[model samples]
Target: MGRRARARRQQQQQQQQRGEEDGGRAGGRRGAGWDGGYPEIVKENKLFEHYYQELGIVPDGEWDQFMGALREPLPATLRITGYKSHAKEILHCLKNKYFKELEDLEVDGQKVDVPQPLSWYPEELAWHTNLSRKILRKSPQLEKFHQFLVSETESGNISRQEAVSMIPPLLLNAHPHHKILDMCAAPGSKTTQLIEMLHADMTVPFPEGFVIANDVDNKRCYLLVHQAKRLGSPCIMVVNHDASCIPRLCIDVDGRKETLFYDRILCDVPCSGDGTMRKNIDVWKKWSTLNSLQLHGLQLRIATRGAEQLVPGGRMVYSTCSLNPIEDEAVIAALLEKSEGALELVDVSSELPGLRWMPGLSHWKVMTKDGQWFAEWGDVPHSRHTQIRPTMFPPSDPEKLRAMHLERCLRILPHHQNTGGFFVAVFVKKAAMPWNRRAPKPQGGTGEPRTCVQPSPAEPTAAPQEATGPSEPDPEPGMPDAGVSASPESAESDGARRDGVCGPPPSKKMKVFGFKEDPFVFIPEDDPLFPPIQKFYALDPSFPRMNLLTRTTEGKKRQLYMVSKELRNVLLNNSEKMKVINTGIKVWCRNNSGEEFDCAFRLAQEGIYTLYPFINSRIINVSIEDVKVLLTQENPFFRKLSSETHRQAKEMRGQTRYAAPSCCVAGGGRRPCGPSCPRTNDCTTCA
Candidate 1:
């Protein structure tokens, strides 16, 4: 409060501004500082500028302040109706503060005992280990500062909206045994969320659910794999294919059609991504009303594909982070138009936990291609274009299909709720179509029987495959075993099995062959080259071809080219202080080190070499080009180790510690709150 102190503070602020302009930027984009550029175009766009103003934020000054305004205190209570036993665990976490007397709350006009907020005592909120997660507590607001902390914690501050979008997994009402699909999933948050939902809590082991998280981009498909493992979910399968082509009628060995219907499906499809303004400011720079107008076609295509895969009365939540009506209401409207009343939007405001929202527009007018409201409103004078005018609601008639009723669709407004805008519409297929109504006939012109059509990966099938059971072997020798060996060489050699791994070896039988006989395979406690893993094999005999690429790297310089469930687990579960030496892996290098390149550069292989920069651990797949570049690229590091030592060093660094520095940091950071001269001050190394 002294004059000298205030003057010093002001001087420091000015210097900080100069440093920012002079390139003292530190850390990767995720660090708690500027991502170091002008506020993203998306953040500065005309529309987004207004959004910031509505939130009482000054757009130009502080970007984080603009974002923090979007955060609101989440409701403390989550109602669980059917699963009382499961509800108890949720209640237990909230028992102490707001609902200590669980019995006082009445549901359906009857008194029910609800669990209360649990205590929030933990040494730390640990990650990357199999150790059980401590239940976070519900502490009361004690002081002015303490109230802020509690508010931040309860507002889901532990997660970003990108992470929050994936919470659908935690809200599962379906059985864990059901099969699920994340249609149009990429940059995969929702897919990972589903994995978390189906996966057992810390108290349970090996959850009974399964998921096939697929994406059209072969590159993005691998991301689904990484996210699945990071979230600690084993009950998931990542497929690199289009969603619309998911096969419909896969037949088992018994000649029975594969009825792979899913109890739950997530259609978190592609959109304009307007809701990501806080994180992806680039979108704002290129923001256009036209882009959203075009995405409506793809969004509908992906959603309809998801619906075709849902079991009767099964739940599929269609969602997008974009606030544009075209990506939300219009797409849902189109799907309902095509379903012939077979698919009905399910009310989700009452179904989900955390927050409530207003339903989607039941009736909406589409703007004409010429840029005027089309229906009864007709043409507008050119002079009127500059003026903002609201269109009148169209008159009802017995003729055209009524505006697809979407009272079930829900929208989240950033201004109204102080949260990123989002739209969600949950749809359920009706119990049964009228018996008198017959499906359309196939293209031939005769009095012939109709045939069952198989669904494509993009079409969304409704059947969930169970682990196959043993039966009479096929008349053809060895037709019974599938996925017995994952190596390409072995699949090629086994004439007995349809899928084979081929190598030059003349006398290689099978490595393992009891898949149908036994779904569970055990590994010894002390296995060297391979770590222990729980593999869930798909049992649908007629499903699309699923294969794995596994091999040992051979060269004068020895290396390993294998990616497995076991190795992924090891990196995800261990953390000790370690140093990161970059390996040219693209995913690990995003927004890093000044060099940027498209990951799609290599197509000859299915994977890449990943060096755990921290531990020197190496992972191999289709190509190690990126990892090689990352490791060899010049930085401040000096290479003093032997070639062999270098290989080992690179492999060790490929572990999780090298991947997620934020999660691995202790007490978060070493530097003091204010600036000090690293040249003069004693800098504590991260190690």
Candidate 2:
């Protein structure tokens, strides 16, 4: 390139960074260059510089390098979708076939490999390229690699977003049998990961525990379903609610209903998102001191609510796509201070084997265009317009403050990992947060602190009227104290069915799934449709909370879903409180064919994974070759199958990539590239 051309480009970028006109290079869209295509390197934002200097965290010597990294496009990184059947083979295929195109490349006299596996990720399923996707699009050496991504991403075998986005899911430590909640899930890559973790322990499709993925946006909740649907987790229940005021919920244990709580919560809140400058190029031009400052209050409330919803000793990971102090450490500090000893930060350096990260800074600053907002115009009414909160600023005594534990938080900067910048803080609820009681007022009158009233063994919230169910003594001695029922009647009573605690912000939108019907109702055991279907699949009658059916948002066929006992109780208890966008995986679809095994009720692909363990019959095992053929065909029916295999095959012939068992089940679900199904007895080995 000519020197003049480079100089002109640099000058244009500087003007854009200063919030000057971008002349038409960057357009008005956020991540303008990154919507399904390559993103341009970013420019320097001056206010961002002033804000970073105030924090005094970055070393002065490396400051320029840190600043420069944000402007550079992030390296392309992709992870094997963990639960997919062909995940391992796809990983091998990339290294052996596509990546082989760029072998032995030389850059500045140094030999460079194509893609290197991220050692931190399990089984080295993740990879990173030194070159950015934007450059790769134009590079001749990696043409096959780029084409591989294009093909696999469309096939749902790969996710092609920024790599730093993958960090939170890794740190979440989700697992089967653990009730998990993802507050603010959308454009849901992380939620998908959570679902994978929920199903990770399953040899069959069903998991004992399930994921309750909540997002405020109704539309985005559907998107989350689409992303989560790829892995075919039947255990996922997608709901929409404001994270700050999410309602307390209940679930049925054994045969009785009780209040619900989560074992794990992910509070990945929305922020200024300047850390995404590498991918969202518009951040370079739109960056301002007020971005994080304005969002501090909302972020704090979301984190606080997540803490409230967590079970005692449950871990909640708070994260953001922002590098700003207010959004990262300050929000966590404020939550810790408000918890008053109920929360403790977990040191997680040793968690992900080889993950490299920096500790969160104990010290940070609150800055605005006119210097510190709190120290300057904080008392002014106009400052409230910027949504600045008192908790956003540093504490008077840093050690006496919750900010002291900030050192345990993880900060991922662009330069440190060749990815986007991110901040993650894991907190364990040591005890129930003392809500409803006002602390001694602080120096200035700020907005009201967090308030929640829910009953638990440790902290009883508002005492709810006893639900009407079968009268039975508590099964275990301490079960009653923990709100576990001995056994509910056949179902909850009609009169007590609608009981709930009043909480949560008023729903902005009027539409909700299963709002008209009592959402808590389980599928009746006597339902003629379910018995035949259960018998066809050889299911143990009590397998999942199959009786608990909530109408999902995809109500086109009036799709009825089955949720975990805990999730059902939550939906029932929190009904009419927060908006319920969608929940549960559909187990029974609208069908009237009445063919016994395949008619009147079709097993949803989403439900099949969790259903695998409970099913005692009707699952026909196919060879690896058969699995591959089924996965590749849109409407595959095999004549080569045994009669038993043919019976199930015809039933699943027109369905999504479901029903067929690979060496293991995977959907974005696909067939295995290796050996035949490993499930014993349940699958006939295509004999």
Candidate 3:
């Protein structure tokens, strides 16, 4: 019998022996029968144990400890938003207020350990707590702390994420000037981290960088939108697309069209998620070797596409939550071989000082679900050839295997650090891919004279022509091409071609799926809506007027949003090529009562930080006590304020706006308001 079958038989024998011992000790009591009311123990999975045992992934004499750690529940972890100016204040509150109260508290006869900072995470912004979610909800001693977490999470001041999931973004090392992309970003916790890294300086209201977060599921794209909205960043754009075939977008640079390449890419592909078994109990029953086998192709495709779009010398991190070598080292080896020296694995052992991890495996065996093992591709039977591919095996040449440096990949295990298992491999692009190294023909009469036409907002732009370099070698029979076409030609083609230089022949474009969003309409520079607001606020001349846009085409615009100059270039050029789910930050909201104040648009809380620097006049500075009263009581009379503050408020004749420091209003759910006359019809409008 194979190893798996024998292991299962042995497990059954042990269970039977234990049952007999228990029955004899009970003296055949009626309540102790086999069918008695009792919950079944669910911690065992013979096949899971057997599969790992064969691989020998656990160190000598540590297998029992490894299995023990997987059976325990995962602890709760949270991260404070580091880019915000009030992040220090929130951390202070967590340490001094909440941690101090829980010092001597015990729940359900268990002592609760004080939460500690994740040493690897910078600035002590992240914490690890022994208390699980169930205890946090039911324990009266932690009630106030629980409320604090809920409030801060809702306000986007903090995030609760798995500790290991936060590693990829930090390893990405994003900067304010780099263009980043998050492939398969859904329920976006890591995407928010990328946003925080881009805004690390905090003083720059609008950064040059932007993040394009893409997910295959249409519904999950909204989750990304919700997360980005909480951070209130203008540089984030959520799009819906299959990461394996995400389109090549073009941008206008110096009046010339150029393909857009990212400086950093996060390819966190989907896997069997055996590492998450601690928190997601269902994985214990659902995991199988077949899952990694099926997902190998899709994962490689996504990583390859990300590499193709990365600029030379740029970095891309490929990560998964599975410990299976078939999904981790095997995939990285295949990608390295395909790159042909254009990509290399980066050694990041010293990046995270306190992180505990093992080097990636250089050797592993492949097994079928039926307990059939394959030492090499030649060992597979002809009937099973279709199920297994050569790329799934390690390189046969020992020297070539050593040269690839597969050991540079980091494998994080749960037993080492009370966290989920994760595999991360950072790659740096040395040159263009073999197939994409063709020299471009110069524009303007290099070939036949062709008219350059701009596509309308309603029409899709023509797809770019496939580049032709030296013929590439054929891949294995079942292996897919690394550079897959983003949009394929429709079957019913009319045989029309827009000049050969423009793109492919006329064909039906890929159909955009999901809810159709409102078109982004930029207001005219001379629009009638700008003069009054500009004069009232004394706006600076350097303010970008064309970047302000409304969602509606022709109506009383309810909300006006703003995007950075770099993002505006992308939106204007590639609106037809990409499926943008949401972008822009709300900067102005229409208030009907504001007509009496000579301006109909009022400041929005979501974007006050972005607009605060451009306003040259009509500013009010209030003290901390005044801010407390404004937050506690809605629309208090000016007479209640201190003398100096009352005089400043009375000097403003029309409707007034209030701006508070970030620390004072970080998690406070109150909205500040101006003093209003009792006889007025609107409470927000000043007399």
Which predicted model would earn the best lDDT?
A: 3
- Residues 231-283, candidate 2: write the lDDT tens digits: 65556777766676666665555644444668899999989998888878888
Cα lDDT tens digits, model 3, 1-687, are 999999999999999887677778864434354466654448777888888898877787988889999999887899999988778889999999999988998888988899999989998999989887777877776888998888788767889999999999999999999999999999899999999998898778789999999998889999989888878788988988778767666667778545678999999999999999888888888778888887877788788888888888899999999999889998899888888888999999999999988899888888887777897889988998657777778989898899899989998888998898899999999987776654343334253212112333243322222211112222221122233222323211212321111122222433334546667777777789888778766788988877788877657888889988888877765655567788878877787866655677776666756776677655555666755665556556656656766665556543454231101111112222211112122222111
**lDDT (Cα, 0-100) at 440 in candidate 2:** 38
For model 2, the superposed segments whose C-alpha errors exceed 4 Å read 1-42, 104-113, 130-157, 253-258, 370-388, 401-403, 436-521, 535-545, 548-560, 587-598, 601-606, 614-687
* Model 3 weakest lDDT span, ten residues long: 660-669
Candidate 3, residue 215: lDDT = 93
The per-prediction CA RMSD against the true structure, in angstroms, equals 19.3, 11.6, 10.6
Q: Could you tell me the TM-score of candidate 3?
A: 0.82
Every candidate's lDDT: 0.40, 0.63, 0.75
lDDT winner between candidates 2 and 3: 3
Pick the TM-score winner. 3
Give the candidates in order of lDDT, highest first: 3, 2, 1
Off by over 4 Å in 1: 1-172, 201-208, 231-233, 249-255, 367-404, 431-687
lDDT of 1 by residue, 1-687 (tens): 999999999999998787676554443342434565643232356554443243332324555654454332222222221111233433334344434433354434645334232111111111111111111122222232234324422322221123236335434354556667776666665564454455334333234456666676655665555544444333455544445444332213233223345678888777787676644556757766566656665666667666766677788888888866667876776666556676787655555444545566545544433444433334545664433122122224434334455656667654443445677777787642222134434334542332222222122222222211111111111112221222443233333322222222211221231111101111222423222111111113321111122221231111122222321221121101001011011211112221122111111111111111111112222123322433344331214323543453455345323421111111112211111111111111111
